[model samples]
Every structure is written in C-alpha cells, then in structure tokens.
Target chain A: MKRSKTMELGVGLFMLAGILGLVFLGLRVSGLSLSVPADTFTLQANFANIGGLKPRARVTMAGVNVGRVSAIELDTDWYDARVTLELDGALEGQLSRDTTAAILTAGLLGEQYVGLSPGGDPETLGDGDTLTDTQSALVLEELIQQFVSNMVRD
Target chain B: MIPRVIALGRHGCDLLEALGRSGLFLAQSALGWPSREGLYLWLRQMHFVGVLSLAIVLVSGLFIGMVLALQGYTILIDFGAEQALGQMVALSLLRELAPVVAALLFAGRAGSALTAEIGLMKATEQLTSMEMIGVDPLRRVVAPRLWAGFVSLPLLTVGFSVVGIYGGFLVGVEWLGLFEGSYWSNMQASVDFIADVGNGMLKSLVFALVVTWIAVFQGYDLIPTSEGISRATTRTVVYSSLAVLGLDFVLTAVMFGGLS
Candidate 1:
C-alpha cells in the first residue's frame, strides 16, 4: 500500500510538472514580440472585406508588424467590414490622414493581414479616427469564379 | 439450402448475444449507486490507476514527440517546407498521437491489472462470497475500477500531450536547429484551442470510458479457473487497444467533419 501511494505521488507530480511546463511555454510563445511595444493607442480601419482576417493577425507596414488586428465587425446598415487595430504609440505619429488600410494575403494561400500604407497627408490620424479609404482582400475563389464565368460567356 | 439457413441462424444468434451482453452491462452501470464506501473505494482505485501510470506515459510521450519532430522535419526539409514543422508536429500530436498513446498505455497498465484482479477474485470465489453475503459486487468492485479508469485516462492523456509537445519543441528547435521563436510562434498561430487540443481531450475522455468498460466487463465475467484469469487479462489488453484505435478513427471523422 505504501509503495502504491509513493508511485501515485510520483505520477501526480510528473503530470503537474508537464502541465505547468506547457502553460508556461504557451504564455511565453503568445507573448513573443517583434512589433512595436504594447503601450499604444488603438485605431479603427473600415474595410469592405476582411476575408480570412483573424484576431491576432499582424498589422504590417512596409513588411514590419507595427500592430495587431484586435477585432473585426460588420456595419449592418452600410454592409461594410470594420476592423479594430492596436497601433504602437511610437509608430502612431507616422500614420497620416491619407493612410490606406489594405487587406493583403501574407503568403500564397496564407492568412490575411492588414497592410498599412502611410499616406502623404501632413496630419496624422488620431486614436479614435477611422481610416475611410480601405482596400478589401482579394478572394481567390471569387476571382476564379468570375474568371470561369467570363470565359464561358466569351 | 438447409446448411445456409443454419449458418444464418447462428449469425443472428451471435449478434443477439453480443447485443444482450452490451445492454446488460449498460444496465448494470446505470442502476449501480455510489455509497460512501463505494466512493472511498473509487478514490483509492483512482489513485492507483491514474497516479501510478504517469511516469510511463511521460517517458513514452517524450520519445514519441521527439521521433515525430525528427521524422517530420526530415520530410518537410526534403520539400523545402521545413518552416511548417511546428504546425505539423503540434497538429498531429493534438489530433491523433496524444490520446491514442495515452489510451494504449492505460490499456497496458490499468486495463490488464483490472482484468487480472477481477479474474483472480472470481477464480478464488471472493466475488461469489461477496454476492452471497448480500453485497453488490458491481458497486463494490467493478464500479470502482471502472470509475478509476474513466478518471485516470484523461489525466494521463493531458500529461502525455504536454510532455510530448515539449519533446517535439526540443527536437525541432535544439536538435534540428530550427528557429525556436518562429517554431513556437507558428504552432501558437496555427493551432486553434477548439479544433486541436479541445478535440484531443474530448476524445481522450471517451477512450477512457471504452478502456475501463472493456477491462472491467472482461474481468467480472471471467470463468472460474486460473486459466480463465490469464486468458481474460490477455483479451482485455488486445480488445481495449483495438477499441481505442477504432474509436480514434470514428472520433477523428466526426471532429474534422464538423470543423471543416
């Protein structure tokens, strides 16, 4: 009985260690940062489409992640997609009034990401301001469907 | 014509017997009540089954993860798609390897022991004496073992998955020289909580039920002989392992179907 109890204790500890290790690793990985620091004001970008845009998808400017897409929603009346972005405070000053938010494919058939083009507007877009001029993602399947229909029509 | 009819009748009889046995087993478990004594017995058994099987599961899980990473890296490298190694290892471990390996380990450790202990009790007339003495052996014996198995299997599965994933990370990052940050980042990005890890845990719970049920049922119905005990033990391992694999396929189909 004592032997069995000892064995049980050992196993329980082993399992606990494994579980805690996983939790630690998961937290560490999720906290990985190459983008600008977190202390930044959040911005909103309105797009017509955010196909494959998931929460936590990176917001890149010039191939560098400066922020992350925090939320996505649809405006019911206008039938437009609205994305909430969290921009690093340091980089916020660079985003001009003419900044265009384009939903772009990260790789061939990869997840969609928001790409920002810092426009030439001298005034910078503030925290609560929305970028009205946005480009939607190009859906490959829809493009193919259009192409096939055009071919058949021709 | 008569021989063919006889063969058809035999097949029907076999099917009916199997169905009846399954129905009786379910009825027994459903009708069984848990008293204080039964609860204590269950807790004790759980400590034995779950707590004792941890090390074996961890060691096996670690090796399995390492091997998967090594093999997956080699294959992906051949196609110059080595960047996807983390996702591959994480996906496979979560969806398939973790639960299956944990169930197989439980079958070998607890399942066999359950079979042998119950079979020995039957052979020694301990079970019969308990029944004669106005004790419900189902509640006292079978239920505890069954409950232990159901509780233990999932715990072991969680352990296996955690250790296994770490082992894979070690192999992929340290041994294979893959970028540690990118490997972990890809895994975190690609693996969804609902689709991969949650599905694996759900499958593990179901597999636990199947493993315990088969083990206890085989043991409880053992013939009154030493040879019977040996046979039951062997059959318990073989049958439980097969059931785990079969259930894995069915669960995979249902899970991926819903997700896709």
Candidate 2:
C-alpha cells in the first residue's frame, strides 16, 4: 500500500510536468493566444500584383508593426489581388480615406508585408472601408526590362 | 533452385502470419477499458516510461538546439540575415527535430525495457500462471504500458521543443550577441501554432502508438527463451526507430506539402 501511494504521487507529478510543457509550447513557443483582442477592425486594399504576400504577415505603419494581414484573395470583380488587414481597434477612426497601402519587402530578400502611409484627408476610414490609393509590389524583372528598353532607345 | 524457391515462400508466409497476429494483438491490447487496479498499473507504467526518460530528452534537446543556433548563425551571417536564427531554430525544432528525436530516444529507452520485462516474464512462465489464476495477462500486463507510452511521448516532445528553443536562445542571444527581442519576436511572427507545433504533437502521438505497439507485441509474441527475449528487445528498438523515421516523412508530406 505504501509503495502504491508513492507510485501515485510520482505519476501525478509526471503528468503535471508533461501538461505544463504542452501549455508552454502553445502559448510561448508558438505564440498562440486563447482569446482574440476584442478591439480589432478590418480594412481592405486591392493591388495590381501582390507578389508573395501571405496571410499572417505583418501590417506596419511607419515601420512599426500595427497588426497582421488577416486574409488575401482575388477581387473577382476587379481582377486584382484583395488584401484584408486586421488592425488594432485603437487606430480604427484615425486612418484617412485616401491612405496609401503598398506591398513592401523587409530586406534585399525577405518576406513581404503591407505598409500603410496615412494621408492628408480629414475623412476617417471606418470598418470594412477600402483604401483606394495603393501601390503594387515591385517586380525586379519588370524594372530590368524597362531599363534595357530605355538603354536600347538611347 | 527448388530449395531457394521453397525458402522464399516460407519466409513470405511467416511475414504474413506475424503481421496478422500483430494486428489482432494491437486490437486486443488497445481497445479494452481498464479496471480500478489497472488504473494504478497505468500510473506506475507512466512513472517508469515518462519520468525515467525526462533527463535524456532534456539534455539532448538543449545540445541539439545550441548546435543548430551556432551553425545557423554562421550561415545566416554570411547572407547578412543572422537575425533570422530564432525563426530557423524554432521552425526546425517544432516542425521536425524535437518529435523525431524524442520518439527515437523513447524507443531506445522505454520501448526496449518494456519488451525485455515482458519477455522475461514469459520466459519464467509468469504469464501462464496469471492465465491459470483467471487473470487475463493481456489486460494486466500490456494495456497499461501502451496507455503510458501514448500519454507520455507527446508531453516529452513538447518539453523537448520548449527546452530546445531556450537552448537556441542561450547560444544565439546571450552568447552570440544577437538582440534578445528580435530572436523571440521573429520566432513568434513565423511559427504558427496549428501548422508547426500542432502537427509536431500529432506526429509524436502517432509515433507513441507505433513504438509502444511494436515493443509490447514483440515481447508477447516471442518464443519464451533467453535468446528469444534478447532478440525481441533488439527488434523493439530497431523496428520502432525505423517506423518513426518512415512515418515522419509520410506525415510531413501529408501535412505540409501544400500545392499553393
């Protein structure tokens, strides 16, 4: 009986430790959250070409991360790449209607992200509002082609 | 030529017979519910399988992480992307190495022991005595160990990944002078919970089931002799290790081989 008691105690501690490790992996290592932030709103932008933009990529304002790219899909009506940005609720009413959204890379070769530059317009963009002014991701091949064509003309 | 053909056919039949028996063995040992005493037996087994293996898992995980960071730092520095070390280390450990390495170690540490213990019991006719006394040896002997392995391995894998990530942090940030904030932040940004960590846990779960099944089945099905016990113990380790590696490839292809 005494031996069984100690065995039970040891097993209980082992189980606890195992569970703690899993919880740590989910929360800390993977950065998963149990609850979504209550204050978040989505804004839409359309690009001629988004290049390699993926969902969950960062959305930055002046190089500071503000939110994430929640979704990217084709705008069937416009034949353009449509991106949905889930931004912090605090900045919901601060962005102007004419704000420019550009697809930018982090470094010489890095993952692509969406960068938002606020505009001079006083009209605030609200939930689900679409940004009209947008710049497509820069393609190196196209730039090279244009440079070669200009050189030939010269 | 005739003798060679006969030998080939005989080995084929033996392989089929063993495969069928193991299938039935898995079903019998895995499907039944445990009685009250059986619960204690399971707890005891968990203590043996999980607690006993923790030290090796942790120490090896730490060293593996440190080595990865050092090697990744050297390579990434050449590309001027040394800051991506955290993302590289976390992804590699969470997605691939931790679960695979932990399962390999579990096969060696606990799987072989389970086989030898059961094999020894059979050799001494203890299992036959249990049957003579009306206690089902399959329920009393095999089920608890199987359940213990199933519950223990994923936990160990998770523990391994957590320790390994910190080990990388120790080397990359503290020793190598990479900024601490970017190391963690970059990892957080790239490592998805469902895609990387969740798939890793699933892989360990499958490996746990396969490894324990092979261990117990090898022991129960072996000839009751000293030499037989030794052979079964060796087969448990080798078969489970091979199974873990092969299954990892299949699972990775299914989980991450996205067309898009």
Candidate 3:
C-alpha cells in the first residue's frame, strides 16, 4: 500500500509538471493579460472576405499590433463578413473618417489580420461607426488560380 | 506435383481459418459491447493506459520538441529563414510528431504489457474458465481494454503536443536566442485550427484503436504454452507499431488532400 501510494504521488507530480509546463509555455507565447482601462473602442469593418481570420487575431496599424479582432459576424443581406476590431485608446484620435481597413496576411500563407491604413482626413471616425470602405482579405488560392490562368493565356 | 499442390492448399486453408477466427473475435467484442460491466472495465483500463503513461509522454514530448526546434532552426538559418523555426516546430509537432510519437511510446509500453497479461491469462486457461462460468469474456475483458485504449491514446497525444510545443519554445527562445515575440507570432500566424491540432487528434484516435485491438487480439488468441505467449507478446508490439505507422500515413494523405 505504501509503495502504491508513493507511485501514485510520483505520477501525480509528473502530470502536474506537464500541465504547468504547458500553461507556462502558453503564457510565454501568448503573453499575460493585464486589465487596463478600455481606452480603445471597437468598430465594425465590413469585408467581402475574411479568409482565415479568427478571434484573438491581431489588428495592426503600421505593422504594430494595436488591438485584436473582438468578434466576427456575417452580414445578413450581402453575406459579407463584419469584423469587430478594438483599437488602442491612444490611437483612437488618429483614426480619421478616411482610414481604410484592409485584411492583410502577415506573410505568404500567414494568418489573416486587419491592417488599418490611417488616412489624412480632417474628420475622425466616431466610436461604434462602421468603416464603409474596407478591402477584403486576399485569398491565396484565388491568386494562384488567377496566376495559372494568366500563365496559360500567355 | 499433386502432393505439393495439396500441401499448398492445406497452408492456404489454415491461413483462411486464422483470418476467420480473427474476424469472429472482432465481431464478438463489438457485439458484446455497451454493457454496464463493459463500461466499468473500460474506465479502469483507460485510467491505467492514459493516467499511468503521463510521465513517459511528457519526458519524450519535451525532448522531441527540443530536437525539432534545433533541427528546424539549423535548416532555416541556411536559407535566411530562421525566424520561421517556431511555426515549423509548432506545425510539425501538432500535425505529425506528437501523435505518432505518443502512439509509438504507448505501443512500446502499454501495448507490450497488455499483450503479455492477456497472453498469460490465455495460457493459464483463465479466459476459458471465465467462458465456462457463463461470463462473456468480451465484456469482462476485451471491451474495457479496447475502450480504455480509444480514450487514453488521444488524451496522451494532446498532452504530448502541448508539452512538445512548450519544449520547443523553451529551446528556441532561451537557448537559441530567438526573439520571443517573433517565435510566438510566427507560430500563431502559421498554424491553422483544423489542419494541425484536429488532424493530430484524429490520427491519435485511430492509432489507439489499432494498437489496442492488435495487442489484445494477439494476447487473447495465444497458444496454450509459455513460448507461444512470449512469441505473441513480441508479435503484438511489432504488428501494432507497424499498423500505427501505416494508419498515420493514410490519415495524413486524406487530411492533406482535404485541406488542399
């Protein structure tokens, strides 16, 4: 019985170590979250394609992550993707009415993220307003198909 | 010529008989399943196979992860794409290494033990006695082991992948001096939910079934002798490992085809 108990304890410790290792790795890779004031507000960006966009996907402005995709919904009438993005509070003032939200891939076949191209418009987009002029995600498969077609034509 | 033909025919008949018996055994286990006794046995077997094997899985996973990162970094550096190491490590672990390695480990450890135990029981006529006593051997024995294998294999594979990714990160960032931010960013960007993790889980499930079925079947049908039991045990490990590898290749082909 004592031996069995010791074995059980050993096994338990091993499992705990594995779990802790995983958690530590996850935290390191994903980073720990600190609760901060909601300085950045969320707004919807309508797109014809979202590609492979998922929640927790980064929202970048000028190649820096300002926020993340908060949610995604499908537009009922047009069947377009409506992506909600949270912007950093500091950059909220900088986002003008003419800011173009384009779904961009980080690298070849990389994850889709929302890239905000801030425009020099005098009027700024108000909170909760949708960005009307949005560029959809570039589908790699479609691009390849088009490339093949062009090559054949040539 | 006629005598040689007769001998060949006899050998073929024996082979057919063995195949028929194996099929019968499979059907018997399947038909006898879903009982209360079977469920309890299955739970116990799962605990043994899954819960007991955690330590071995973790250790192997960590080492495998380290190796993957080191190898991937070395190769990528040559091409000026060292930054892609994290994504390569994560994708490989999630889709291929974790599930296959975990299943192989299971086959080496649990598969051998299971085969030996069942073989010994058969050799001692314990299974025959259970049958004589009107207890369904399939329910009392095989189903639990089968179910335990099915449940434990996938869970162990998940544990292996998670630990492996963590290990890779540790090696890549801490030892190799890769930027922490870039490592994770590449991993997050490259890995897809369906193609990587989901594929590994599916492969693991199939591996579990194959490993347990082959091991248990070999043991249960052992000849009534010590030497026979030993041979069966050895064969069980060899056959089960081969089956896992074969199944993995087929599954990978199907998954990649679907994705592409």
Candidate 4:
C-alpha cells in the first residue's frame, strides 16, 4: 500500500527473478535437478566389466541418450556387474529382450556407459527382466596384446 | 613489570568491552527494526548495492571466466580433453570466484558506501538529533542497510557466475574453436545443483552477513568526526575483505572437506 513498501516489493521480486534465472541456468549447466521428473522406468543389464561405468551414467542408443544408469552392483557368482537402467517412459516399448547392451566409452578418453543395439525379438522388456545379451568393457591393454599377437602370427 | 602487566590487562579489557558493545548494537538494531519503514530502506540499499555495483561485477566476472577458459584450455589440451573447459570454468566461478570476488567488490563499493553514509550521518549529528527526538537510529538507519546486504549479495553472486560462464564459453568455444556440444555436456554432467550451486549460495550468504556486519558496526560506532568517519569506512572495506576470505576457508572445509 505504501510507496516505499511497493518499491521494496518490486525490487525483491526483481532480485528473486534474477536468482531464479540463475538457478535455472546453473542447474542446466551443472546437469542437476531439484526434483527429478518421474516419467521413467528401470531395466537391468549385466556386463562382465563395467570399466568405470558409474551409476548415473548415460545410456545411449544410436548416440542418443534415452536413459541413465541408475545403479551398478557386482554379482559374485558371475563376477559381472549388474547395471540398472532408468529410461524414459516412451522408450520402454522400443526395447526388446534380445537387445544387446555393451559398455562403451564416449570419445577417445571419456566416461563409460551402456550402449544398446536393437535386436529382432518380439518380446518387449519389463521391470524385473534382464537383458541377456551384453558385451563387457574393452580394455586397451588386451587390444594391444591382441594386436601384437596378430603381428607375430602374420 | 607491574605496569606492563597492568597495561596488558587494560588492553584485553578494552577489547572485550568493544566486542560486547558491538554485539549489543547489532542485537538492538535487529530487535528494534520497524518492518514497514525497513521495507523502503531495504529497497534503497538494494538499489545502491545491486544496480550501482552491477557493472563492476560483470566486468570482473567476465574477465575472470575468460582467463579461466584460456588457461584451462592449455592444461586440458595436453590430455586431449578440451571438452572439459566448461566444467573447469563453471566450477571455479560458481564455487570460488563469483562469490569471493563479488563480495570483495561489494565490500569496496556498497560496504564502504554504507559505512561512509552512516559515519557521515553520525559525524553531522543527524543520528544524535533522531535520538534526541526519542527515535532509535539503529532501527531507522542501520537495520535496513544490513538487511539489504543480505538480499543483494546472493543475487549479485549468482549473476556474476552466469556472466563468467558466458565469458568462459566465448573464449573456449567461439575463440579457440573447441567443440561446443562437449563443452556444455561435460559441464552439465559434472556440475550438480545441490553440490555446487547450493553450496555456493550458502557461501555467498555467509559472506553477505560478515560484510554487512562489519560495515554497519564500523559506521554505528564511528567517533563522530570527519577523519574518524573516513577511517571507519576504510576499516569496513578492509575488515569485510579479510573476514570473507577467512570465513570462506572455514566454510569450505566444513561444507566440502568430507564430501571430496
């Protein structure tokens, strides 16, 4: 009601807008969220080696991110890592039980993640079902070893 | 030996007395603050701190980011990891540079101004006249400026980070021809709102409190003379800067020490 109060409120609101804009941009830059949107479903895939494939790593198909690796655990019996993939709800119908997931690195020296290659199976994935076809992490040392062995054989 | 001991005792007593009085002054000002009158005065202080100080913050923040990108590129390129330029720049600015530099500048600009304005008011007997008429100068004069410091510093720090990030982007992506997509994506992937931004906001808020406290305390306790007022203004800037830097270390240790 008072002039000073009105001016004060206006300034407060202005500052608040600036702050909100800042938080929005900062979050976008940081890739963090206050509340994660709940339009996702979780699926499981196993890898012989996750090779630093951390939880919350991106899951991509055809180089497009459709999901994130929500959790990773080691199964002692198989000595493989079980990766839980939380994917966009829309992507649920697109994946099949026969989809072959591979742990792959981005760029030449970047973080590792799961890459899904589509399969020709009729059955779609569900909550508890796991993808049986998986490729483990490709270690550079092993590749070099194989390369040297090939040269020797030649 | 007796005289020396006595003098040391007197010095300690003086320090305690000053500390007690400053605490009382701050508490009274906060307690006696008039809400309606405070709103207007806060706006005035906010205008002085935020609008007037915007250019200095922007210029410094931009240069700081640009320098980061330029330097970060040199180091990251050695590993062929130039895409990480954004994350480096953003982390440094959001976590350290933006809050620390803006608070230092705010200490120089608005903190000194607040101290000078109040010190001059005291020197000119304006505060005395208000007191003589049964008005509390602490409520009318001091509280609003203090509250304004609390309000303005956070906004300025955030804006400073934004501008600084743009500066880094300009250098890393546009000037140096680094890939833009990776620059942005790597940054987003690394920076988290709760860890980086929220912690930064907390740091700035602490700095705001310390800087404003020093400014208002120095001005309110000014000796009511021209030289005294000027000296207090200088002390406001000096003490606020020192406190901000020192407290930043403690806060970082507490906030990020274990997390890292």
Candidate 5:
C-alpha cells in the first residue's frame, strides 16, 4: 500500500523532536560538564583532620563555589592536612585573611568540601597566603563514639 | 516414566531449535535493512509504534515521578534531607525505572501489537501472497518492523524520563512546598551523566533488540489460525517482559557494581 509522503515526513520530524528533547534533557540534568575553570589563583589551608575531603572538591564562600581543591598533602612539621585550593581570579580580593576555611559535608551522607565563613578583619589574603583558621570534617563515627562513651559514664 | 522423559527431551530440543531458527531469521532481516523503501517503511512503523505509544508512557512516567517524590519526601523529612528529593527521583528514573518500565510497557503495547498484526496477516494469507508476488516478506514486512522497534524504544525511554522528571518537580516543589532551587541543584550534583543517564540508554537499546526480535519472530513463525495468532501475541508479551527484567538485573550488576 502506498502511503502519503508528507505524513511520513511529518512523523519523522516528530521523532527527531522527541530525540532532541532527550538530548537536551540529558545535557541539562546529567552534570557531565567538561568546562573547567582555568583563570584561578591558588590558596592554601591547614587542617588537623581532613577526613575523606577529596581533591577537586569545591571551595565555597557564602554557599557559592569560588574555587576547587587542587591538591592535598600532609605537612610534616604540623602533621595536618595541607590543602591547596584554586580560587577563581574573578574572586581574588573577595576573600580576606580571616576567611576561615572549614571542611563541611554537602548533605548528611554526601561528600565533603571546603566552606568559607568570612571573619572581621582589615587585612586581605594574597594569592599564596595560608588561611590560619581551618576546621576539619566532623567524623560521624567519632561523634557517635563520644555520645556512647558519655552515656556509659553517666 | 519413559514417556515423560522422552517428552522432556523433545521439549528441550524444540526450544533450542526455535532459538537457532530465530537467530537465522534475525540475521536475514538485518541483511535486508539497507533498501530505501525499507527505511521509509521503518519510519512509518516508528510513527505507529513510538508516536502512538507516547501518551501511555508519559502518563505512567508522570505518575511514577509523583509517587517517587511523595514517598521520598515522607522519608527524607525524618532525616531533614527532603531537599534531595529531586536527586532521588532523577536517580531512580535514569538508573532504573525509565529503561525497565519503558521496555516493559513497550513490550505490552508495541511488541504484542506487532506480533498480533503479523500473525493476522499470516492467517489472512497476506504474507504468503506477498511472497508469491515477487516481494520478499523479510525485506518488505519483517525488517521494517524490526528496525522500527530498534529505533522507537530508546527514544520513547528518553521521552518517558523527561516527563517523569517534570512530574517529580511538580509534586516535590509545587505541591509539597519544597525549595525549587534545591530540587534541580541536588539533581545536577548527584546524577552522573555517564554512569546513570548514559547506561540507562544502553539498557533500553539492548531491550529494543530483545523485544523486537521476540515480537517479529513470534509473528513470523505463527500458525495461520486464530488460536495461533492469539497464542503468539500472548507469548510476545510474556517472553519480552521476562527477558527485559532479567537483562535489567544483569546490566545493572555489570554497569553499577563494576563501577564501585
């Protein structure tokens, strides 16, 4: 049986639209983004206990990401986690010398990243300045152990 | 006891024989896939199979999304993490529900229809008459449908997932009064395009092969009678559904388990 060519073409276009919609959704929803931030200045923070705070984790200020963790090492002298953060050049002077970098979990069970809560200070942080105040990840196991031990003592 | 043993041996042999024959038929249909007319016919069949099946898949996706959000919200509230509802719903759809549910529905709707249509054509002697008139039934009839099933299902699965995510958004944010930014941001943060979304598409593509093969083969081999057509149609659904679920488990185990 001969079918109308126009209707078939229309259906083909409809099919194209559906698949394109999926492609758009996949790009938008699935964060397989490849664009990397290159124009960044490096900063460092020292922590007593990093606790699963991985490299490439976002370094955020005021709940907005301003940098990413570039590297993590152990300081032989202080025996602490020495993390290097790649702060965006656009946010160069936004952070002050007293901007405290704390390792915080995204959600209760989610991954750990560096968060900044600015402090009262007239001094500003330069590209290579080390943040003096740093808080480590709150280990759930440690908290639970403390609670259990305190309860047992009571 | 001797007769029972003989019947069991015969049944196993019949199963193997059908499998071998289907493999040959599948290859032959694939060979006939390149003709221009075959391509046009395939698009038409896709219009029938995919476009026609859109409403049910989207509606089911919508409801499935709403239910996931509602349930996720109820549980997440206890932990004070109700904001991750979008991540939960998106993960559920992309990782599991979209491919598996869409394939099952495709089997139920398009697979059975293909089987029944071909079986009826055989019963009415249309396939036989077409072959007698110098038209290769494999090229003209079977190949187009097999191609359509291949082309239609993954696209349908994509559409289903899209609709389902919106459905989750509607229920999770609008009705439940959750913050909208968290819904999208949490999803963007949690769901990986490669592992979850990309693998979901792979699962659907594999299912399309399984389903269309079963549907077309059942219809082609059907006996030319009303009872035979009905039985073939029923088998198309049953067998395709079982194959999809079983494959989904194996695929999930391989894709996700090997990752971590």
Candidate 6:
C-alpha cells in the first residue's frame, strides 16, 4: 500500500522535534555542554568535615559563583576530606597564597557550598595549590549537643 | 470447599499459561532486524503510536509542570525558599513524573488502540487469512507495532520532560515572580544529566517494552469475540498502568536509593 507524502513528512518532522527536545534537555536544562573554557584552573582544599558538599556544588566569592566543586575524597594521610575546586580561569593570579576556604550552607537546611575569602598575602595561588587555612562545615547537631551538655553542667 | 480449591488452582494455572505464552510472543516479535518492507511497516505504526500521541503528551506535560510549580511554591514559601521551586519542579519531572505519566498516557492512548486494532483483525479472521496465505502474521503485523512502540516512547518522554520544565518556568518565573536566573541556575546545578535525565530515559525504555508487550499480547491472545476484544483492551490499560507504577518504585530504589 502506497502511503501519502504527507505522512512521511509528518513522521520526519516528529522525529526532528523529538531530537530537538533531547538536545534542549541536554544543553539548556541539564547543562551538558561539551566545551570547557580554556582558562579554568583547579585548586584543592582539605576540611575536617564537608557536610553534604557535593561535586558540582557552587564555589562562591562574596556571594557570587566563581567555580564548582569538581571532586571530593578522603585523604588517607591527613584523615580529612580533600575537595577539588574547578575555578574560572579569569580569576587566575588573583587569589593570594593564604586565601581562606570555608564550607557554608545556603539556607538553614539548604545546600552546602564553598565560600572563598581572600587573604592579605602578596603571593598569588596557582593551579592545584592547596589552601592551608580552611574552615570545616558546621554541623548543627553537634552544636546543639554541645549546648545541651554545657547547660546540664552549669 | 474442595471444588473452590480446584477452581483456585485452575485460575493459577491459567495465569501461568498466559504468562508463558506472552513471554514466547515477545521473543518472537522483538528479535531480528527489520527488512526494507518491514521498515515501512514500522514507520506506519510509528505514525499511529508516536505522532498521534504527541499532542496529548505535550499538553499533559505542560499542565503537570505548571501544577508542580504551583504546589511546590506554596510549600517552599513558608520556608522562604521559593527560589528552590525550579529545582524541585525540574528534579521531580525529570526524575519521576515525565516518563511515568507520559507512559501511563501512552498506555491509555496508544496501548488501548493497538489492542483494539489487533483484536479486531483477529476477530475478522485477518490473522488466520494471512497464515493461510503463507504469511506469518507475527512478522507482518506484530513486530512492526512492537518496534514502533520501543523507538517512539523514549522520544516522546524527552519531549514531555522538556515541555514540562518550561511549563514550570512559566508558572514559577513569569507568573509567580520568581527570579528567572535562579530558576534555571538552580535546576542546572542540582539535576545531573546522567543521573536524573538518563535514569528517567531508562525507566521509559523499560516501560515501553512492558506496555507494548502487554498491549500486543492481550490482543493476540484474546478469545476472538466482540466482548473479548473489549475486555483485552481494558486489560491493556489496567495492566500497563499498574506495571508502570510498580516498576517505577523498583527502578527508583535501584537508581537513586544509594543502598550501598
């Protein structure tokens, strides 16, 4: 049986539309971009606790996103959490050697992200430089526990 | 009491027999590549299943997304976290709602149609006639429909998710006065492509296989009467919906449960 040209055209259009939807989801929705900007650099920070800080979580300076947490692992030698931050290359040679990296929560019960505060050191940090002065994630439950214990003792 | 026990045993046997037959049917219809003519048949069936169902899927996706944003905003506003509405809506749609709901609609729309069409052909002795003419109705009829469903469903699911997310954006950003940049950026930050979107696609693929198999098998195995066709058609919708919901729990647990 011979089908009409219109039917074939409809199918072709439908398939194209579906593929376009998939591409939109990939690029626009999920942000699956293939190209990485050439100037991005990586920095490492070690923390006593990361407290739900995940890869791809934002790294901010003065409440503006400058990078993302790229990887996280436990350092066997130091017994602390090792975090890798992928920063925008545009900020290269700006961060001092003594910059403080702290894990901060967005809202009271919200996501955990890294907050970087610049230091007074004239020496600039480079790619893969480890931030020595770092503040660990604040655990609310631990704080409550300490408060209860101190109150009982008093 | 003994007669009732015997009846129960017979019903169990009947169910097992049907299950075995459908498994065999799936094996027969799903294997092997399509020849040139078979490709044309598949295309025609895709028209029936995919193209025809597009409007309903898109419309449902849009409304569902809008509703999700509205509901999530109401809840998140109490916490002063309404900015997370975009993330909530996108995650829920991509991870759960879009694929499952689209499949349920597909089962109701295309699955029921496939069952009825095949059942009517069987009732009219078309399948028997093909067999008498030395043509395997399984190859000529069933395979095309099965392949069409398998290919069409995943594409439709993607379309549903994309439309649904924008629907959320419309409700959350435009109507409700949420920040547009935060809406998109929060979604982009939280919803990982491989974890959330890929898992949803995987769920839809499995659903496509099960739903189409149930639709075709119920029709092919029907008792070849007007009442039988109607019963099979109803069964296709009921069974497909139940299977989709049930399998969703199992798939969610495996994919996102992080059991380890």
lDDT of 3 by residue, B11-91 (tens): 999989977987788777856438765655655565577678887988999999999999888888777677787888888
Candidate 2: TM-score, chain B only: 0.97
Give the range where candidate 6 chain A is weakest over 10 consecutive residues by summed lDDT: A30-39
Stretches of candidate 2 off by over 4 Å are: A1-6, A147-154, B1-6
Off by over 4 Å in 6: A36-41, A62-66, A76-78, A88-94, A107-109, A120-128, A141-154, B1-8
iRMS, model 2 (angstroms): 1.7
lDDT of 5 by residue, B1-260 (tens): 99999999999999999999999999999774277777778877887888888888989999999999999999999989998898999999988999999999999999999999989988999988998999988888899899889888898888888889989999999999999999998888767777788899999999999999999999999988999999999999999999999999999989988844
**Which has the higher lDDT value, candidate number 3 or candidate number 5?**
5
Worst 10 residues of 1 chain A by lDDT: A24-33
* Per-chain TM-score (chain B), model 6: 0.98
Residue B136 local lDDT, model 6: 88
Q: What is the C-alpha lDDT of each candidate?
A: 0.81, 0.91, 0.80, 0.86, 0.88, 0.93
**Error in Å for residue B163 of model 5:** 0.6
Across B208-258, the per-residue lDDT of candidate 6 in tens digits comes to 999999999999999899999999999999999999999999999999999
Candidate 1 per-residue C-alpha lDDT over A1-154 given as tens digits, one digit per residue, 9 for 90 to 100: 2235665565557557647644543453233334545587788887777788988888889988788888888988788888899987887667889899899985464568899887888998878788878999998888999999999999
User: What TM-score does structure 4 among the candidates reach?
Assistant: 0.86
Supply DockQ values for each candidate.
Answer: 0.23, 0.66, 0.12, 0.45, 0.47, 0.67
**Which digits, one per residue and each the tens of the lDDT, describe model 3 over residues A35-115?**
655678888889998988888788988898889898998989888988899888776656888889998876664567889
lDDT of 5: 0.88
Calculate model 1's interface RMSD in Å: 4.2
Of the true interface contacts, each candidate retains a share of 0.19, 0.66, 0.06, 0.58, 0.53, 0.58
Ten contiguous residues with the weakest lDDT in model 3 chain B:
B37-46
Q: Cα RMSDs of all predictions?
A: 5.7, 2.0, 6.9, 3.5, 3.9, 2.6
Candidate number with greatest DockQ: 6
Question: Which is superior by DockQ, 1 or 5?
Answer: 5
lDDT of 3 at B3: 100
CAPRI quality band, candidate 1: incorrect
